[model samples]
Target: MSLSDKIKSNPSFKKIAHWLMIPTGQHRPRLWIRMIVNPFKHKRGKNSIIRYRTRLDVFPYNHFDLGERSVIEDFSTINNGVGDVFIGDRTIIGMGNVVIGPVKIGNDVMFAQNVAVSGLNHGYKDVTTPPSVQKVETAQITIGDNVWIGANSVITAGVTLGKHVIIGGGSVVTKSIPDYSVAVGNPAKVVKKYNFETNNWEKA
Candidate 1:
């Protein structure tokens, strides 16, 4: 069975695991206890703050991959072993987001609420085979500098988001995006080019 199936099948074990993770003699405010109880064992980074109300489901981390000054806010779920997720400096993974890794996110990036960043997909090459029954394919997701991923967006595997790309809320980014474009909707499309009318961004 998959890891997810194992978690479902042994709810008691899961509860026990949470109970075991409680740090002794650490004074956390009552409001923040549940959120601080259990975090993925492999998660490590400098100054990575997961707030009081957040929930990271079963995520793993690469210790060498740093999350410098990053904030994973409340109600987010980072799922079990896909691979390592590297969040760069000054990144904000907002509330209610889910990230399954093998993803390298760049500096100053913001992922809004309910955003999903996944690095795995199901394969279905055989005509007679259903996609759900097929083996899973894995890839890496790379986000460039100064990108803004809006609320409720889903970024699939093997995709690279260029610098300064603004993905609108509720977008489904299946493919790669170019630099400085504003994309929106399911199967996100570039709707407008970034025009600097106020000398904020100069044309290249």
Candidate 2:
């Protein structure tokens, strides 16, 4: 098993590691951990630009990668505490976006302002326990090449957007969308698809 896997499987190790990385009852990482340790563990591709106002709540335990020429705009928040976050080359993550991993975004993707893409979900099945402290569930969210996500959209856990797909503004994507398709609305539905034969976008 990998070092991360081993640390996770061992309760004692996890507790100690968690304490070292994060301050008691705090969500943000310690200053030393962020300045000293994270620079070595996290990977930032060449030419990637992370805006000064962006908040990266990432730790060394989980992987975080930003591809070459990718840009994370101001007021955006990226957290990889629950899982890994991977962004491919030349992608633009717009302002005020919230991205929680395990999310893999492909190359040349475009995201408008205020988009929220999360792969982590809290488990509140137990009545006696508060959801905040309960075990969290995670699923990977995959976005293929050239996908475009509009403003105020939410891409929920386990959803996949195939290559060249487009998500409309204010949509909540709860399901997977196929390649070359356009999806919109809450619990987003596929409304148009590119037909290879005609090279045209036809209503679905």
Candidate 3:
């Protein structure tokens, strides 16, 4: 049987698992506790840390993949929503962040507090129908290695961020950003680019 089927078959087991993950507010639960509880519904690598009060969506558990030593801080929510979510090694998802898949984030990524990343958008093509009832449109969001997303940033669907990119605080990323670029503002625009010859970041 599928993992979801198993969990459905034994509701008590699911309840017990959630109970074990209750936050203590002191520190992250032990690795063993996380392993046993397995709230994300997927296998996570060593030293994975989910801080106190963080919430993970349960439906698409098997679709989530967290690499080694990744830390998701308090109040963060990761929702798979029938799509794949991959967080690479040593990535830090700061407090109150919401990450929705299909999204692939590479190694050493840092997302500041309250960052929102999502790959699915609600469609509102038919004026007669309620927006909520409309079909969902989905596309993959890919963030390459060494990306640092500042606080309160929103990364929308189908956006690709290249390696060594930096996004300023409160920015809204609606399109792909090139490697070694620093982007800021609503509908984020490249403000700086890394100069290979000078080894400095220069205004774009």
Query: How many collisions per candidate?
Result: 0, 0, 0
The per-model lDDT (C-alpha) reads: 0.74, 0.96, 0.86
Ranking by lDDT: 2, 3, 1
Best by TM-score: 2
What is candidate 3's TM-score against the reference? 0.80
Per-candidate alpha-carbon RMSD to the true structure: 8.7, 1.5, 6.8
The residue ranges of model 1 lying beyond 4 angstroms of the native Cα positions read: 1-43, 57-66, 125-133, 195-204
**Per-residue CA lDDT of candidate 3, range 132-202, in tens?**
76889989999999999999999999999999999999999999999999999998999999999999999
Clashes of 2: 0
Ranking by TM-score: 2, 3, 1
Model 1 whole-model lDDT (C-alpha atoms):
0.74
Select the stronger candidate by lDDT from 2 and 3.
2
lDDT of 1 by residue, 1-204 (tens): 987468657989766544444343422223233345223344446787878776544422232244778888898866445567777888898999988777888999999899999987878897799997787788999999899999989999989999999999999999898888888888988876666666353332
Residues 125-202, candidate 2, lDDT per residue (tens digit)? Answer: 999999999999999999999999999999999999999999999999999999999999998999999999999999
